[model samples]
Target chain A: MKPINEMKLEFVSKSSNESFARATVSAFIAQLDPTIAELADIKTAISEAVTNCIVHAYKSSIGKIYITVQIFENGKSIIKIRDKGCGINNIKQAMEPLFTTGGDERAGLGFAVMQSFMDKVRVSSKPNKGTSITLEKNIIPRFIKNGQPS
Target chain B: MDVKIKLTGNTLTACIEGDIDHHNAKEIRECIDQKIEEESPNLLELDFSKVQFMDSSGIGLIMGRYKLMHILDGKLQVINIPENIKKLIKLAGLASLNIIKE
Candidate 1:
C-alpha cells in the first residue's frame, strides 16, 4: 500500500544513538497524533530494533543503521530498521523470548518486545549480507476535548 | 543513565535516574555492580521513580541484577516503577523470576 507520508534516516550503529533513533522516529510519528501510550509503545519497539543492530548485528563495531518510517492514511504506521552488518542465521530461534547471543548485559528480549508492542513485526536477514526488521501498528483516532476523549 | 547509590544499614538503595537503554544500561549495571561488591548489602533496592524512559534494556538491567544478587545470596527488589513499565515487567513474567517485586 502506498503511504501518505514517509521518511528515511541513516546513522552510525552506536549504542548512544538508540535513544536518538527513538526520538527521531517519535517526531515523525507525531504527525499521526498518537496517544501517549501508542507513542511510548512505538518508542520502545524502535529502541529494541536499533539496539539489536548495535549489539547483535554490528557487535559494537562501527556500522550504518538505516531507518524508514511511513504513515498511511488508514491510521497505520510502518517503520523499518535495517543494518548491513552480520545477519541472523536463525530467525525463529532469535525471535524466541529470552533468547539472545549477547551475554550478560542483554536480556535477549529485543525481538519479544518488538513483537509485543507492534501489531505486526517482520524480520528478514541473510547470514553474510544484512538484516532488516519491519514493524507495523495502527493508531486509533480519538477526538479530544478538555484533555479527555470526546 | 545515572545511578546514585545510598547505603543505609544493611540495605543499599540505588536510585536509577535518566533513561535506561542498551547504551547506558551498561554503565549503570557496571556502577551498581561495583557498589554491590563494595557494600555487600543484604537487600538491593532499585528505585526507578525518576526514570524517564525505559525499554527491554531496563528489563535486562533488572534481570542481570537479580542474577547477581542471587549468586551473592543477596536479595534485589525493584520499586517505584511507572505504570507502563510495570506492564512491561508483568509481560516479562515476574512470577517466574520469583524474587522480583514491583
Candidate 2:
C-alpha cells in the first residue's frame, strides 16, 4: 500500500471561508478516482464539518480552523478538521441526531450528515481546549462498460 | 448563483442554478424573497435541477423561505433534489418538509 498523501489548509472561522474550505477539499479529493456522486458526497461532508467549526467551535471567539485531507493509493480518503476554540462538553450528546446547541440556525445535523456521507467519523473534544473531527471514506471506483475506469 | 422566478396563476417557481454556499446565499435570499413578495403566490416551488452544489448556507436559505411561506400562508416545495444534497437534507431532519423529487 502506498503512503497516504496529505494536504493541509488553515483559514479564519468565518462564513466566507466555508466555500474556500469546501473547494479545497473537493480539489484534493478529485485527485482520487472518485465518481461524481462520491465527489459530491465528500464535498458536502467537508462543508458540514468546516461549517460546524465556524459556527459552534469558535462561537464568539476569534480563531482559525485547520483542515487536513489525506488520500491513499487504495482509494481511501481521510479528512481531519480541528478548531482551537471552546470545545464541546459532551461529544456523545452533540452527536445525537437533531440535537443542535440552539440559536445558531443549525438543524443539529452537521455531525449526522458527516457520518452518513463518510465511511467512518470520529469526534474528540475537551471542554476548554479544542475539537477534532476525523472522517474516512473508502472510495469504490466506477468503471465504464468497456472495462475502463469511468 | 442565478435565480429565475416564474409565476403562473397562484404558483411561484424559483429555478436555482450554480452553487448555494455562504458566498451567494444573500443574493439568492433577496431574489427569492422579492419574488415571494411581488408575486404573492399561494404555492412556492424551488427547483434544484440545475443546482450544482449546496452547503449549510443552502439549508439556511431553505429555512428562511420556509419561514416566509409560513407567514404568507403559502406552501413551499423543493423539487429535483440531487442524491447527494438529498442526503444532507434528510440528515438535517428536513424530510418532514416533504421535498418532492422529479
Candidate 3:
C-alpha cells in the first residue's frame, strides 16, 4: 500500500528514548493539525508501545526499536512499533488487563490504553523472535472554520 | 520531567511537570516514595496541573503510590489533571481508587 506520508525511525531500546520517540511521531502528525486530545491519544499510545519494547522486549539488554508511521489522506494514521527481542509467548495473556510480566512496576494497562485511545491495535509476536504492535487512528479535525464547526 | 514536592502540615503535594511515561515514571515513583516515607503525610496530593501528557505508566505510578499511602494510613489525591489525562484516569477505573479533584 502506498502512503501519502511516511516516516521511519530506529533507535536503541533505552527507557530515556521513549519521550523522544513520542515527540517525534507527534511532531510529524502535527501536519494533520489534530486536536490536543487527539494528539495526546496518539502520543500516549505511542509511548505504551515503545515502553513495551524497552521494558519487556529487550529486558535490560540493548536492542533496536523501529517505529514506522504512515499517514494517509482522509485523516488516518498507521503506526508500527517493532522490537527484535524476547518475544511474547502468549499474546492473549499479555493483552489481558492487569496481566503484566513487569511485576508491580507495570500497571498492565498498556495494551488496554492503546485499545482505548486508538481505532485499532494489533500485536504479532513469536517467542525469541520479536514483537510488533500496530496502532491505527482516524483523526477527525475538531476545529471550526468560518465560525462554524467543520 | 520535573517533580516538585511541598508539605503543608500533614499534606504533601508533589507537582509533576512534563509528560509521564516509562522513561520518567520510575524516577517519579522513587522521588515521591522517598518523600512519603520521610514525612508520612496524612494526604498525598499529586498535582498534575503542569502535566501535559501521561500513559499507563502514569496510572501505574498512581496505583503504586496509592498502595504505599494506604499502608501508611494515608489517602491519595490527584489535583488539576488535564482533561485528556483525567479521562484516561477515569477510563482506567482509577476514580474508584483515589481522590480525583477536578
Chain B vs. true chain B: TM-score per candidate: 0.92, 0.94, 0.96
Candidate 2: global Cα-lDDT? 0.81
Candidate 3 lDDT tens digits, A1-150:
567899999999988899899999999998777988889999999999999998999997999999999988777899999999999998999999889989887899989989999999999998998999999998875454235666
List the per-model TM-score of the A chain.
0.93, 0.90, 0.93
Residue range A1-150, candidate 2, lDDT tens digits: 654688889888887787788878888888776887788888888888887887778888769899888888778888999998889988889988767774434556677778888899999999888999999987775563237965
Q: What is the DockQ (computed on Cα atoms) for candidate 1?
A: 0.77
Classify candidate 1 by CAPRI docking class: medium
Off by over 4 Å in 1: A144-150, B98-102
Candidate 2 per-residue lDDT over residues B6-90, each given as its tens digit? 9999999999998887567788888888888888999899999888898766887787788889999998888989766876676
Scanning candidate 2 chain A in windows of ten residues, the lowest lDDT window is A141-150
Better of 2 and 3 by TM-score: 3
What does candidate 3 score on TM? 0.94
Q: Candidate 1 on B20-97: residue-level lDDT in tens?
A: 998898899889999999989999999989898899888888988998999999998888888767657877886586
Better of 2 and 3 by lDDT: 3
TM-score of 2: 0.86
